[model samples]
Target: MTVKMIAVDMDGTFLNSQQDYDREKFSQLYQVMKQQGVRFVIASGNQYYQLKSFFPEIEGELSFVAENGAYVVSEGEEIFTGEIDPEIIQEVLTILAKFKQGHTILCGKNSAYVNEDEPDSFIEHGQKYYHRLKKVPNLFDVKDDTLFKFALSFPVEQVPEVLVQLHEALGDKVIPVSSGHGDIDLIIPGIHKAHGLMKLQELWGIKNHEVAAFGDSGNDLEMLKHAGYSYVMSNGQPRVKVAAKEIILSNDENGVLLKIEELLGN
Candidate 1:
């Protein structure tokens, strides 16, 4: 099967906690992929600003599945957008606040508002990698219209119950996805990784058998299961491995780059 498109996740699948990337290897593979007419779509739960921060130079070439499939962009143009209803967001926020007490993050297009600041690797990583990233102490101060994602982190074990509660509260209005941390993500209705990636395929006229994907979390499962040739990182979650068609080396091991090289050689 010929792979005409590749969709990859960011945090665990591409960037490590240190915010460092295998730039040289990735650049080389990107060049090869381009030469072969393969389109690269970045599929993640991150907001548009967050995704653009990583590869600012490719704003024109890259397509994105931002806010966990709530939005889709191809060639700097929007192909689809599924924003959560404002009322639903407010309701969900109230429910989350009740459970979280003081540890929730409400994200807009370009910023994140928090109930209380907590120490997390994501906070530090944002400081190091993002330009003009801001933090708000409360969601009450946040104005809507650009709201995209609501991410919250609590004690790891609390996640299962928290997710169930969110599903119960939001129902079909929003969907929950995980970033593979203790965090849970709330996105607009019908917006999942799989849906967004499939949209990308249709936009580019690429068939399911012509698509490949790489990811490392529970959030990545749907697409990993649906892609033509899905790959899970060696360090990825066990369930991700179960869903993937193949297993590659860890992100730190330049697994994606090596695989791309093999694909090009063949």
Candidate 2:
């Protein structure tokens, strides 16, 4: 199938376990894609700043669907921005405080906010994913910022119960999407990577049939199903694998770049 735009998920689909990719190889592939008029988009639940840092050479030539789907940017321009009500954000902060969710981060358009009391481990990890993070005395006091989503971490075993509690407490305000590993993103309802892709499609006048996507895990399910050509990494969860049109090599193998090379070669 002919593809006009290609979107990829970051965590487990493009970056490997250590969170690095073959930049030189990707640069070569991107040159080919640009020449063929194929748009490149980074679809990730991670912060837009963090994701953009990965593509320094061609950052302006691409698009970003970050904070799940709360923020969408194309070619250095903001296409869409979804935010939660201030009252609802306060409620979420209360609930998380009750749970002692020290790993929770209040993501905003300008920067991500984390508790100053959190462990150093959390701070270190947060720094890697959120380039512009602030240590706040209290999340409730965070004002004058457009909040996007909340990023939380939990033990793999506790995720299910935590999700149920979040659902019952938050009701329809938030949607919890697993971004793989122990990370869970609490995003605003009706906002997701697919919504970001839809925005891009409208701007570029492209159809789902001409779009290709790659992802792996809960948050990626919608984007995968939305694209005509969807691929899940072999290292992805079994359930996620079924949602894609085909399975590819693990991220550590640079499966995404390999597949793109094959597609371009054809």
Candidate 3:
């Protein structure tokens, strides 16, 4: 099958368990894909700044479906954005307050806001995914910023129940999706990785059938289905595997790069 654009998730689908990839091989592969007019898109739940750091060599050339599709950046420009209403953000924060546990981050276009009272370890962990993090006295007082999503981290065992409660409380106002490791992101309704991909398709005039997507978690379900060629990493969640059209090796094995090589007959 012919592929024009490729969208990949970061954590488990592209990066290995160590959160790193085969840079040498990927750098080479990127050059080849560029020459062939193939677009490489990083679709992740991470912030745009964090995603951009991974592709310094291909910065402007790469596309980003960041914040789980709440934001899209192409050619170094923000082409589309889906921000949550201020009132809705307040409601979500209120529900989170009831839990009184887990780390909460308010995702914004400029920076991510976190509670100043969080433990240093938790703040450091948040830094890993959110590059532009700011400690705030109160999340409710965060103003004059374009809020994208709310990301929370709870104990792994508490994830299921927390997700259910948030869904029931928030209803149609937000889309709560897990990005594995007990992390949940509250996205704007009707906006997700798939929606971001569709926006890119329109701008590039590329058809869905010409897209190849790789992902490994619940948040990636819609994206995998949207592509003509969908691959679930061997290490991906069980439900993600069921939704994908095919399966490939784990991230550490360079599954995504290998598949692309095979497709390009390299």
Largest TM-score belongs to which candidate? 3
Model 1 stretches with alpha carbons more than 4 Å out: 115-141
Q: Write the per-residue lDDT of candidate 3 for residues 1-266, one digit (tens) a residue.
A: 78999999999999998899999989888888989999999999999999999988778888999999988999899989887889988988887788876789999999999999999988999999999999999999999899989999999999889889888888888888999999999888779999999999999999999999999998999999999999999999998999999999999899999998887769
TM-score of each: 0.87, 0.96, 0.98
Residue 195 accuracy (lDDT) in model 2? 94
lDDT of 2 by residue, 131-157 (tens): 999999988999889998999998887
Better of 2 and 3 by TM-score: 3
Error of 2 at 99 (Å): 2.0
lDDT of all predictions, in order shown? 0.75, 0.89, 0.92
- C-alpha positional error of residue 24 in candidate 1 after TM-score superposition, expressed in Å: 1.2
Query: Against the true structure, candidate 1 has what lDDT?
Result: 0.75
TM for candidate 1 is: 0.87
Q: List ranges where model 3 is wrong by over 4 Å.
A: none
For lDDT, candidate 1 versus 2, the one ahead is 2
Each candidate's number of clashing pairs is 0, 0, 0
